[model samples]
Target chain A: MRDRLRNVLAGVLEVRPEEICADMSAEDVAGWDSLRQLEVMLALELEYGVRIPADAMLELQSVPAIEEFLTEHGAG
Target chain B: MSRLPTAEEIAGRRRQGLELTRVERPEATALHVLATFNLDLLPPFLTEAFDRVGRSVRPRAGAFGQLTQEILDPASRLYAEPPDEVLIVPAAEDLLEPLFSRPPSQLGPDEAEALVEERLAELRGLVETVLERLPAASCYVVALGATEGPHPHVLDPLAPERRQVELDRFMRGVRELRSLGPRTVVIDWDWHMRSFGWDAVRDERLWYLGRMRLNPTGCAALAELVARHAAAYRGQARKVLALDLDGTVWGGIVGEAGLGGIEVGEDGVGLAFQDFQRELVKLQETGVLLVVCSKNNPADALEVFERHAGMVLRREHLAAERINWQDKATNLRDLAVELNLGLDSFVFLDDNPIERTWISQACPEVLVPELPDDAAERPAFLRAASWFERIEATAADRGRSASYREQRERRQFERTSTSFEDFLSSLEQEAIIDPVHEGSLSRAAQLCQRTNQFNLTTRRHTVAELESMSSDPDHDLFTLTVRDRFGDNGITGIAILRYAGELAEIETLLMSCRILGRKLEDAFLAFLARRAADRGASVLEGTFVRTAKNAQVETFYPDHGFERAEDGVYRLTLTQGAVESPASIMVTVPANA
Candidate 1:
């Protein structure tokens, strides 16, 4: 699940999947702006068939938060 | 056509498109996109859409919520580097906020009408500004559709308070912009939303998260719609639809089922075929030529058209047919030869997978679409297909099938004549040559783009470019219309001449294949030479730039008393007098010329 979330984030951020760590947040990444954050939320929703709520979109900026949210939504 | 890509695939394609743009490619079409809402998700889907039609577009997104500013301001990025095409997408909620934010009951009828009028006028101004600034760009504007709020009088059929009435009025007003100029194409956003369903087009989560109105799925669909229009604008739209009979059109094989036993009537699956044929007839009316390319006995197929009770397509509706046991690929090639059209302009519809595969391999230029497995789905499939999409259908387009039928009769007339000179005189051809006017601008531009075989220099000029040239004092644009005893072939030729001191150069000279062998080219050249001599030019020049298909016209200039001075340039001295028109045809030139 962590690797899958890392891959989705890497695709959206246009970085290497190996370089994406679970502890990395939007602030830590160089290219993860607000627009890239929205892309990350969309990619995660499409990949897991899960609708990340509008309010939770901004909160799931880190790879760990996205993994936890996906698991809670039964996508893990 | 394949199914619409999923959101994941769209994202991946967007990345691929971005990577492709990093490496420079020559002759790539520049496309500038401006919208009212966030269009960050559109570039990737748009890239894939243009790529599907074998065109590479470099799309640059304008600032969000700056649709009007980008067009109104001259120094905007849109004008910094002019684009070959412009796509302007304005949302109803953003453009018409007063109508949506306030309930209909709060405003009077006059007030509502006045508000809608004001917004439409502003939109027209913006579109006209774009058309004026970019004389070579083709502008595509999306009409306003339904707003996102609820309606109090939604259930009422004739309620004035219903927002749909106002939206409908706005859409109609937007459609009128097509007449503003030939290059402006107004896309039916309302029809697209209704066809795609409102839920798929609008995402509430995205609306709140960002200002984005459309989700990834909706973005992909809209991109495809724009791409289809782009294809039509580039003169790449399909012209002929080759159909198969038997299990493809009707329920069973006519050879075995007999006319009476066939399942094409007013009930069950038979009605499905009937409905599908009705849709095809609509397509025919829009100027797409319908031809039969079936592998059956000629008698059995002709009998179906003669005696079938439920047949919607009659014998006269078909422009041509190849009802034989020959292979479809060979039959298509024969049809291309008969119709004087390229094989790339054909769309083959057949139910047999083997035949489709065979044609796809043998004649790769022909577009063979996959029909649905179920017969009931075929009508909807035809409606959804965008192979014959046109921005506006001209009068000549509506009467194309009839003209082709007349062409067949003319061929028969030619075979019976004693000699070539006798045939030319017996046909009684009349040619009317005139300067390009407002009424004939679209067809004139169309001739410039679609004519290939007889073109001297193949320059595909846009309507906007031609419109500007017609008003310039240095250029003369002429269009020719030919009429014979058979029928009137409308606006079949175009020629553009640019003057400089003592020299007048033929920038573009092309005639439709319908009137190629008729010696009308000589008469048309004569008219041009006279016009150039009257304008005080001493030398009339023409060039033959070689294309794969235009080789037949290689020696055309030298045959008509032009001396070859350079590799492709030919010069004819006006002091030697213009070439004479053939006595068999009566030619009429403009009085002013």
Candidate 2:
């Protein structure tokens, strides 16, 4: 699961997957924004073929939150 | 896939792409657009069209002896700096003489024919020159000439038979040259005729002088013609034709005409209705979708189309038909909903002054041709409309009319279904999406530039600008080409993903007008959401910059689940699990899009 998240973040954030971590937050990341957040969502869903509910979008606050949500939602 | 080609190669594929996106950039690349003119009968507005497209024109002196020499000799000294996108618009003062009773003898049969041949040869040479310089620059040749009029003196030497001979020969020459490799487009003016016989050229001075006397119908025709060619060359026609019935399709009202009294048949005023129907039917054949908004009993109108012998357009022909006795504005709104067409694609034609005025006031996006009060003038009136000016029509257009008809029938079947979701499920719409690659890049950039409504952050990019984005390591341009069970909608939507360090931004999001309302956009956003979440990116940011035509998408993010952030921005967090594309929407993202 951690490796999968890193691969997705690697492409979206234009960083090596090794550079991404579960502790990453908007303030900690240099380029994170609402726009990039959507890109991350799309890439992850496309990569995993998972369905993201519209209501759950509001609950996503940080990488840890995304990790927990993805695990719960069966997104790899 | 191999690394994307350099920006220069993408711009090299098509020149206009670069021009559109690089307009404000300080560094200007030179483009050579061949604008040929008769120099003998040029219109004052020809230059304006060229100017509108941002081309610097150098008028080549046509084959008029000293005039040609005069333009060529001092030309270098007259303006030292050669302009970018030099155009050669072939216009002449000769065409105007026919408008006047006094005809110029200089354009004798032999001279005119010889000049025609000479110009044909020149055009061929220009094509060769432009092709040789291709990759570095591109040129477009616009062919426009005068038509025969009523003035007999002018008509005497420039007889229709003789002019037809020259025109045929010139056209032959054009075909031969086109075979050799020129990207050529012809604007035929031979069809423009005065009401009177061919000798009407003799009456040019007495009747219509100074003005082209181009009526609404004629303007629409010319615009439609130009638009067709523009689409063919530029790659697609983004405009949609929205229509109205009742007084428009028939004389009197459908509510009042009582089906049989509509007056569309073999006799007197019936001929007017007949002619109008025939012309519109022909337009439908050219790939223009016919949509109807009528205030009538839906069953009665359907019966007319299904039962009437004189009815040329059946109910099956329309992309969308709104037949409720409600305000036309309301019907127009419903029609947009039914077809997923934007208001801008709609060109409404209504004969009734009141209804026409109402629609014009209520839905300003629709182009309503003002018909003359005399029903007798309807034929001439339609001849002058600009709704049909198109630069080119591909094979796809030929099937458009038929496809829309089939689409309507399918919708009707769905109407009886239990729920909208059930209807969507039954139709089997699917969307196939792929990363933006070389094959689809040209078309994708066009959607970004032309699509006006339903656009968020209406960022118009040129092929050049898009190419630059692809080259710059921080930016990613992804295009979505959509097709469904109905027909191929071509490359309809574009998403520009720009990144700064770890964060990504949607710099541009736009969809073609025809593909709206099907939840393809929701699917697109969902795709974006999932992609964003994967990158460990917490929030996906976007903006809705307003334009007069793009209010339809002002609250697009909110409806699609994004929350409004500070200033005009919207944000969505990726932890939002499993975003599903709108419920049971039938969209097919092309597997190879």
For model 2, what share of native contacts is present? Answer: 0.00
Worst 10 residues of 1 chain B by lDDT: B144-153
Models 1 onward score TM values of 0.95, 0.55
True contacts kept of 1: 0.45
Candidate 2 wrong stretches, greater than 4 Å: A1-76, B1-44, B47-86, B90-140, B144-170, B173-184, B189-247, B252-259, B341-344, B394-430, B433-446, B461-479, B483-490, B495-507, B513-544, B548-593
Best by DockQ: 1
Docking class of 2: incorrect
Question: Weakest 10 consecutive residues, lDDT, candidate 2 chain B?
Answer: B36-45
Q: For residues A1-76, what per-residue lDDT tens digits would candidate 1 score against the true structure?
A: 3777778888878888998976888999999988789888988888889998889998988877887888899996
Query: Highest lDDT: which candidate?
Result: 1
Residue lDDT tens for model 1, B1-593: 23556666677677777676767868678899999999877887787788887789888889989999999999999999999899998887787777777776787567877888899899999999998899889899887476443465467744665666676777788888888878898887677666446676667877888788888877787888888888877666789999999877788999998999887889999999999899889999989999999999999989999999999988898999999999899999999999999998899999998999999999999999888879999998998888898767888899899899999999899999999999999999999999999888888877777888999999988777898899899999999999999999988999999999999999999998988899999889988998999999999999998998998899999999999995668999996456878998899888888
Candidate 1 segments exceeding 4 Å error? B1-5, B104-106, B149-154, B157-162
What is the TM-score (0 to 1) of chain A in model 2? 0.82
Best by TM-score: 1
